[model samples]
Target: MALQLIALSPIVLISSYLPFASPSNFSYPAIFNFGDSNSDTGGLVAGIAFPLGPPNGQTFFLKPSGRFCDGRLTIDFLMDVTGMPFLNPYLDSVGAPNFQTGCNFATGGSTILPAKANSTSPFSFGIQVAQFIQFKTRVHEILAQDKKIQQFLPFEEYFGQGLYMFDIGQNDLDLAFYSKSDDQVLALIPTILAEFEIGMKELYYQGARNFWIHNTGPLGCLPRIIATFGMDQSKLDEIGCVSSHNNAAKLFNSQLHARCVSFQGQFPGANLTYVDIFSIKSNLISNYSQLGFKQSLAACCGYSGLPLNFDNRINCGETKNLNGSFVTAEACNNTAEYVNWDGNHNTEAANLYVSSQILTGKYSESPLLGDSHLLAISEI
Candidate 1:
C-alpha cells in the first residue's frame, strides 16, 4: 500500500513556520494530554479496577501501569521523540511523583460526552480539562513558594510553549454504536466535534498554543469488531474489514479536518495540527506483509477462539478452564510482526512505526518537529 498524503488545509499550510527556539537551544518545558485509553498513561489504575497486569505493559514498562496496549502508547512515543520525560497520571497516588514537567488526565473508557446517566466514572473530556485547571493552580502555588523557580511562573511561558495533545473520540463513537444504527452513529459526529471544539477553545483560553490532535482511526477493522460484525462474507471489504464502520471513520475524519480549519481561523496564532491516523493505520493493514506483520486482523495476545483469536471472556494474560483442560491467553513471540496488540490497541512495535511515520510530516496537517529538532531531541 502506497502512503498517500492528505491535502493540507490552507491555514495549516501557512502556519507551518517553526515557532519555538531551535531545538539545540531550547526544548519544550512540558507536555499536557487529554484523551481516553489511547493515551492514558496510568489514569485507569488510579481511578478504576482494570486488570492491566503482566502481558499488557511487558513490552516496555516491564509491568502493567494501566495502559491498554501491550507496550508504550502513541503518547509515550511522542514524548520520546520530543525529549520529554514520560508524564505521570494526575490521579495516581497523591505523593507518587511531581507534576512540574506535566501530567496526564486521560482515563480508559472516557468519552467526549458526559457519561451515561448511570455511569460511575466522571472522567469525561470536560472533566479532564477541569483537572488540568486544578493542575495549573497547584503548579502556580508551588512556584510561588519557591522564588528561585519562579521562572516557570507565568502561565503563558509554562503552558503556551509546551505541547498539548488530544487522542479522544474513539470511545464516543464506540458508545454510540452500542445503541444506535450506522446512520445514527454518523449523526452523532456533529455533537462529538462540538464537544471537542468546546474543549479546544477552553484550552486556548488557558494559554495552549501548540496542539496535536489525532483523528480517530478505523474502528471497524479492529479484530474484535471484525469477529463480531464480519461474519457475513459479503459484508467484508477487500481487506476483510467491515466497510460501513471504516466509512463512518472516514466521514468523521473529514468533518474533523474541516473543524480544524475553522479553529485555525478562530485562533490564528495557535498551531493546531491534525493527524490522519486513519490513513496511516489503514495502509499498514493493507500492506501488513510488506510491513512485517504476520497477523494484521487477529490479535497477538488474546484468547484463542473460533472465527478469530480474540475472546471477550478471556483478556490477554488471562486463563480459562474449558471441560477438563486450562486454556490461557498468551503473547506471541514476535509482537513486532503484528499490528493489533490485544484486538483494540496497537502493539508497541506498531506504535513505534506509526510515530516514526507521522513525525516525518507526511500525515500531519502541518509539519511536526523538523529533522534538526528531532536530531537534537534524540541526542538529549
Candidate 2:
C-alpha cells in the first residue's frame, strides 16, 4: 500500500503542474489542485496545524506556507506558466471571500487509507479533494453573477474548464513496505489499487477531465534511508541501490505501468498518461556529476541522526566542525547541483527538468479526450 501511494506522488505532481503552466495545446481556464505535499502552495492548515520554521521556505515564499520544500511547490510554477492567479491554499481566510479563480485543497502527508501511517507530509488525496469540491461549489456561486463559463479569447477559451489535478499515493506504500512484514505488504496492493482507481473515477465524476498521471519514481535511493541503514558500499554493486528496495520499487512501477495503460484504454473522457519519472529521477541522482549536480546523496534540509540515518536526517540549520570553522545542513554552494532538497523530495531545479518531460509526454491531454484527441487539447 505504501509503495503504491508513493508511486502515485508523481501523478499528483504532474497534475498540479499541468495547469501551472501554459499547456502546449492551450491554457486551462483555472487549475484546481488536490493531493499532498507534492503540489502544496500553502504550508500548513491555519488553526488546524502550526506553521513550520524558517528553513522550510528558505528559498521561495521565504516564509513557510507550511510546504515541506524550500520554495514554491508545483502550483506556483503552474500559475507562472498559465498566467492564472496562484491558487489560494484552502486555509487562507482572506482569499476565501471571493476566490473564484481557483484553490488548492492539498495538505502535507495525507493518504488514501485512513489507517495508513503518518510519514506522508500531510492530508490524504481523498480529504483534500473533498475540500476542493466545496471550494468549487463556492466558485459556482460567484460565477453565477457572470456567464456559466467565462470566455476570454483564443488563449483563455478553455479557462475554468475543470482542470483538477491530484498528487498522492507515495506515503501509503512507504509505511506498508518499509514498516510491515513481507506478506502483509503484498496483501495490501490490490486493495490500495482499487481505492486509488475509485478515487480517480470520483474526480472524473466531479468534472475533472484531461488528466495527467505520474507513475512512481525510484525509492531505493533516498538519502535518509542510506544514511540510516549504513549499508557499506562493498555490500552493493556500483549503482548504490539497495537490493531489496530496488526490487520492490521495480515491482511497484511494473504494476503501475500496466494499470495506467488499462486505465487509458477504459476511460474515454479521462486521458491517463503513465510517466516514468523514476527512471529519470534515478538517472539524475546516479549521474549527478554529469547533470552538473554537486550533491546527490545528501539532504539539504534534514538531520543526520544517531543510528539510522539511511535517509540522512540532517537538519538544515545545524552547525558542525567539518574541515575548519564549521558545517551545517548538506546545503550545496548551488541548489542546481543537488537533485534532492530534503531526503525524500527533489529541489526546484530538478523539478523543472522533470516537469519538462511530463509536459512533452505522449499522454498530453486537451480539455478532454474527445472522440478524436486533437492537438488542440492533446499536447501534454
Off by over 4 Å in 2: 1-24, 43-47, 94-101, 115-122, 142-160, 229-237, 303-314, 317-330, 362-380
lDDT of each: 0.75, 0.56
Ten-residue region with minimum lDDT total, candidate 1:
5-14
> Which digits, one per residue and each the tens of the lDDT, describe model 2 over residues 64-151?
6566666665456645655566677777675333245566776666665653443434456666666656755655565566664434
Top candidate when judged by TM-score against the true structure? 1
The number of clashing residue pairs in model 2 is: 56
- In terms of lDDT, the poorest run of 10 residues in model 2 is 1-10
Every model's TM-score:
0.86, 0.74
Q: lDDT tens digits, residues 52-93, model 1?
A: 787888876788868988778877866764556678888886
Clashing residue pairs found in predicted model 1: none
lDDT of 1: 0.75
Q: Give me the displacement of residue 182 in model 1, in angstroms.
A: 0.7
